[model samples]
Target chain A: MMKNKKMIILLVITILSLTVLTACGEKKPTLNVYNWGDYIDKEVLKEFEEEFDVKVRYEDFGTNEDLYVKVKQGGSSYDVIFPSDYMIERMIKEDLLVKLDKYNIPNMDKIDDRFINLDYDPANEYSAPYMWGTVGIIYNKTMVDPLTKWADLWDEKYKDEIIMLKSQRDTLAVALKKLGYSMNTRDMGELEEAKAELIKQKPLVYSYLGDEIKGEIVGENAGVGVVWSGDAVTMIRQNPNLEYVIPEEGTNLWFDAMVIPKSAENKELAEKFINFMLRPEISAKNADYIGYSTPISAARELLPEDIKNSLVAYPTDDMIKNVEIFKDPTDIIAEYDRIWTDIMSEE
Target chain B: MKLKRAAYPYIVWMMVFILMPLLLIVYFAFTSGDSQSFLDFTFSLNNFKRFFTPTYLKVLTRSVNLALLSTIISLIVGYPLAYIISKEKSKRQNIMILMLVIPMWMNFLLRTYAWLTLLGRNGFINNILAKIGVSPLNLMYNNKAILLGMVYNFLPFMVLPIYSVLTKIEKNLIEAAEDLGANSITIFRKVIFPLSLPGVITGITMVFIPAVSTFVISDLLGGGKYSLIGNVIEQQFRVTGDWHFGSALSIVLMIFILITMAFTSKIDKEKEGGGGGLW
Candidate 1:
């Protein structure tokens, strides 16, 4: 009986190995692309796969930190990844990314000059801009006055009606901007003041939220909230009473960019994928579908007139003059970590 | 000896999957920096020291309090239901247990998310209240909401074990107690309750352990306004990239759980000893 059991196990193992071998024999060269959830049009991927005749293995990540951990752990070999500005800077510093071969990506010229050579990648050598947005207040116009300043979020009348971003940097930026301080301020005192102001505002906050912020505002459960401009645009479309504004004090202007990781085995195919995405038509489809600002100026022309004129998506230069792109906080991350812990842990 | 040989695969599985990860957690808990390699090591008590401050202690206390409250509430609700099920016919008992287990088969996160829609300010409950001319009650994003999530999710853990023990109970003991001129309440107190102590202890441990370490339910139902100990450890690992501190907090929690187990098992042993002499 024991020998028969062993024979059956051996048979099963042989069948498994045969299946694995057949799977490997029929495989095509694959390019692994990782990006934010629901950030791209699915049809663009199908088009790229058909045109290139290569298998496109697509994955989505919830946050920049999740992407960082996956890359840093060396568990997965992704050829292409999309990470936000601060994360891109951190990756470049850690030598986790390969410099982009700009000559191969001829479509780079179509990208607007304003987005090129940004603070995160000053030389524009390591990454290409994918989407850009600003952090701002999205409010229910019926429940709240037209908010022009970040301080308006702290009004007592909106007690248990205000929603704040659960993220560390974005929420802290609101307090910093309200105080007329730099959003990327590294000064310990400024940070402490921001922490204090947030704790004081904690009681009035309906909740600290991430993606759920949109649902709350759209449902009119929250009077106002700190929201990503792109998300605000989408929320306004869902509920007409919702309005988005870039607070007068300005906010964090952030960018998500495509970069080839150092671990990538298919650099050339990754570059091809990037170039295809940067094409005005593909970029416009993505921007229009996702409701985010596209960096390709040509893509902007192709966007419908209403979306093209959206102040939330494409803020005027005057509105963004006081804005700051987030810098990597490697120097005082411990302080930021402590301050966030303090805020969350406080009664 | 043959039975012991049959257990070899399981022992090896436990060592590789359970023992190794625990050893890694301990190793990470002692180290200070972001050193990924095993060779260059600097050991320190700073991670534990950092966790003992008033802010983190408050979070730890909150986690314990909430977990204890949920465990107690689960027991209060589960014990009676379990007792009733135990008294039912054998076929009905299986059906009732199967009904309880059905929700557990669904994803825990999806089940918790469903509660958000049911309890949100603009959710179904509030909508019904609005139609009835009552004001919308602030239901979601509060301590009570979090407690509801915990109890709802972990109630099965509390019930199943107790039900099993209650069913396995020897019928002769209750008959003997009744024959000794005991009323129903007196018979229950003298025989069945004492016999079910083991299951109650198991149920408490099962419920409390998971509830204390839960972060998702709090994040979803509590609205991230409240930070439990699990949330702090999750923050350190996921957001702040401070694995050393996260590992240290995990070690502390493991020790806390170990102590609770020791206390409960001692009670279990004493009861067994007291009952053994009579048996």
Candidate 2:
């Protein structure tokens, strides 16, 4: 009886210890970050982990819409997210972002005033700008005549040589701007006009591209194409023969901002990471690597002269004047989406 | 009671992971709001109304057509390759199939990016064409690119099932057909084809469902210029923040898939009866 009792006690202890060990193994600190693919300098992440001693888990989505879906679903616990200007506006309206404590982010003072107190976060309350760029035409200088305005996309001379952004909002907005309508216009008649214009240009377009637009333009496959300023800058660096032009009629200026989601489990750590990214040296390094215009004024000052002088990074004052920032259409978004689908199905 | 207790964990897992989410989607399909905190419980048909609009309907039809075309193309290309492989010696067959499947082991996004390098104007194919004095083809961001990407991504799915069934087919059956003086074409059509019908059906299902809902390939290769049912549904949820409409689209898509599956299974059952003990 004594021997049997001892054996039973040993078996119970072994099982208890095993259960405790497994439970401990399952607990660990993890920070989840959701951002655009290829938008980050991955080496910086490695350095951050070494310095902070925290496990950083990263996830990427292909589009702003994709990011919005995951966040809106309510169960996702992402610590940090990168969203564009209009998306930030929508998220603020929906109350999806956590208000930042300005004291915790002292480096916030280094950000360019132009990026602060904008339409998305008028008080600079919920988000911090990461990068800003304009939507413009990127062209191979040798093959195409100089592009001056959004109407150049429809010019018969460049028929089948022009590529446009595949995004309904971007493509339609350009047309609307060219037609002298507000980029955020909700008027059904104006939207219809834009739709008609897109259809007219449809036959002349070589293709509609997003990320691939830069590479295609650089390779001389397209004479002129609508492209994001960041990608345009990257392409022009690779091929000196290429030039980026902000259409004289008007173009969309977009800013990507970082925000801490309400569902974040590591809000404190997320704030720290955001502040670190704003450090002048770090911000300048990111701008140099990504080739996107930085929103940090101090960081801009620190960049090499050539980078600062790059026409793609800092367009002429006249060019900047011709650009209009995109605002959240809110109620009229559905109308735009509908018109877009109709146009896509026409062919 | 004892049996029920033993099965409790599995039941709970299924309910929590699968049933709960599906139920939530169905519920949200009729409700409105961005977040759960703001959800209004009033039932509305606005979501369904949006789906029935002519614009969305056109995209749905186009998606169905694309799926059908991809299914047929995959069948034609994959079945023969599978058949040929199945006839080879066992060791060589294993090696060949492994080679075919190796590409799938890489990340899907990486493979899609590889196609960008291959199809771009300065890409390999275009460079070779340019060297030969032919004009560079605009094949990277259009319907042709979309179709090529879909077929490339899904061909393995088609090949695997048909190959499995073909390999299991008894060699004596084909020999028996030849003994009865049936020619090669007649033997294949009457014997091999019927025996492999189950795999062909399975492959069709595997290819069609994914092709219809494929958003990434279309976005990446087609340059997001085209609208498919998947893209429309995705935009509703993500871009417009219209969960109700997105859920409605999802439910409609699910219904369409079920109807197609039912029709396929009915045909499969009929075929099963006509084909003899060739299982």
Lowest-sum lDDT 10-residue window in model 2 chain B: B270-279
Which residue pairs in candidate 1 have backbone atoms (N, alpha carbon, C) closer than 3 angstroms, thus clashing? none
Where does candidate 2 chain A have its weakest 10-residue lDDT segment?
Answer: A23-32
lDDT of 2 by residue, A27-107 (tens): 656678898887878777777787788778999997787888788776888998999988899889988899998888998
> Taking chain A by itself, what TM-score does each prediction score?
0.96, 0.91
lDDT of 2 at B66: 86
DockQ per model, Cα: 0.69, 0.55
Give the residue spans of candidate 1 off by over 4 A. A1-16, A19-22, B1-3, B273-279
Q: What is the iRMS for every candidate structure? A: 1.2, 2.4
Q: What are the RMSDs of all candidates, in order?
A: 2.5, 4.5
Clashing residue pairs for model 2: none
lDDT of 1 by residue, B54-164 (tens): 878888999999999999999999999999999999999999999999999999999999998899888999999999999999898888999999999999999988888
Q: What is the lDDT for A131 in model 2?
A: 91
